[model samples]
Target: MLVKGQCTICGPELENGLPSTSRFRRLAQDNTLVDGPSLTGYYTSCPAMDREGTTVFWRDGQLLAVDADLASHELFAMDDGQNVMGRTLLLGDGRVVVSLDSEVLAFHSSLSPLAEGPWPCGDANLRGNPVMS
Candidate 1:
């Protein structure tokens, strides 16, 4: 539930701090988000399904790790340790959904079965849904 002018965790702060011109930095400057940790896990652009897609990562709500950055805590990019599963579904008209299910953390979206929806399978929703497997 990211809304303008609200202080949410927009994403991980870069290891070296964001550039002055970065949109996320501007958002922080505008008081849209609080300065937060560089949560463990690398950042990746969401699938191009909507106008306001996000950079995705995995963070369980209970893991309040403030000292260690996400980059130092996981080996996801090397594929040497835990494997991560993530998916994104597009519901059309700027509705993009992201799911990270390694161990099922705090999921915020509602999911319909593949067989049931106002969005039909094989339609724009299916084709445009970007999945990060």
Candidate 2:
């Protein structure tokens, strides 16, 4: 599974049902990481994945798209100086929906939609799932 931290995104190799520290793939990193609030008005971090498995996340006020194998690229930059405070939505129509500190915006994504599934957009219950429990 993919994991997102304050300064790095990684996919860890599971060994005996546990993540192996030395075998994790470091997908991306941002030294100037910025914290963002969540829908509940608390600072949290989460990333969304499209149907095509391309991961999308916010870092340093920029929207990034990363593939499964460590290929990452910046998709968009938020110039309004607002933090993305919620989980991104990968709609069925190829649109990316994000909630910022002041407003909600939708951008056309080149990636495919999340369509329909138990874990569409990697959010099983339509919540960000910030806490593992």
Candidate 3:
């Protein structure tokens, strides 16, 4: 299914997961390594294998969403904030990528989610509105 933006470029889809690492590398080329307080707390000092975190994708410096590391490939976006800003491309491999104004970041996904629903604020807004005012 197409995302919520007008299409600027269209290409054939892929059957396998990621066709090439180059695709990821290219999308992440301009994205800088994320660093800051709000993010650092999500990661730990554990070894790679033991490390767990969520992979974040940013476009034009705005956070897209934290990808849920599950077989369902569920994506958890901030319900209170602006929706994903970049143009989304569904890869043939079934993964999604954003174009233009984008960056990608990762952190331990093992951290138990605080609560389910839209925004981190609470579940009250879940039934009322799409975005917080």
Candidate 4:
């Protein structure tokens, strides 16, 4: 059970790091967290159901990647070798490619984007190797 607490007042930090006034205590029962002290931190608008959303999807709910960027965060995209999300990327040749479970597209720095695609349902389909065949 999760209990939300009200921040009666955020205690001031000590000269070092400790709080000056300790007014709250961790509420637990059987070593389980029943309640916790109200915390003061920055928060962004997040979807309760977004914990399992795509890797680098846009705010509009379009999936551009099949993985998540829990590590590297780009301004508008996240890449996971086999999939990407956030914005439709581009190639110097100006061809718009697409990806699907049955089809996966990739680009080589030396090769043009339209050169080849749908190569084969190899890795991402077999052992879920998003990085290679």
Candidate closest to the true structure, highest lDDT: 2
The models' CA-based lDDT, in order, is 0.31, 0.50, 0.25, 0.23
Lowest lDDT 10-residue stretch of candidate 1: 61-70
**Residue 100 shift from truth in candidate 3, angstroms:** 8.5
TM-score of each: 0.24, 0.55, 0.19, 0.16
Instruction: Summarize candidate 4's per-residue lDDT along 1-133 as a digit string, tens digits.
Output: 0011221111111122233322112234445322222222121111111112112212212222221222222223233233222122224442222343345334322212211122111133232112221
Ranking by lDDT: 2, 1, 3, 4
List the candidate 4 regions with Cα displacement exceeding 4 Å: 1-60, 63-97, 100-124, 129-133
Q: Residue 60 deviation, candidate 2, in Å?
A: 1.2
**Clash total of candidate 3:** 14
Runs in model 1 lying further than 4 Å from the true structure: 1-9, 14-26, 29-33, 43-56, 59-87, 90-133
Q: Flag regions of model 2 displaced more than 4 Å.
A: 1-45, 115-117, 120-133
Question: Model 1, range 1-133, lDDT digits (tens) per residue?
Answer: 1211222223334343333222222235455644433344433322221222232233322222121121222212333233343444434332334444443333332222222222122344453233322
**C-alpha lDDT of candidate 2 relative to the true structure:** 0.50
Worst 10 residues of 3 by lDDT: 42-51
Model 3, CA-based lDDT = 0.25
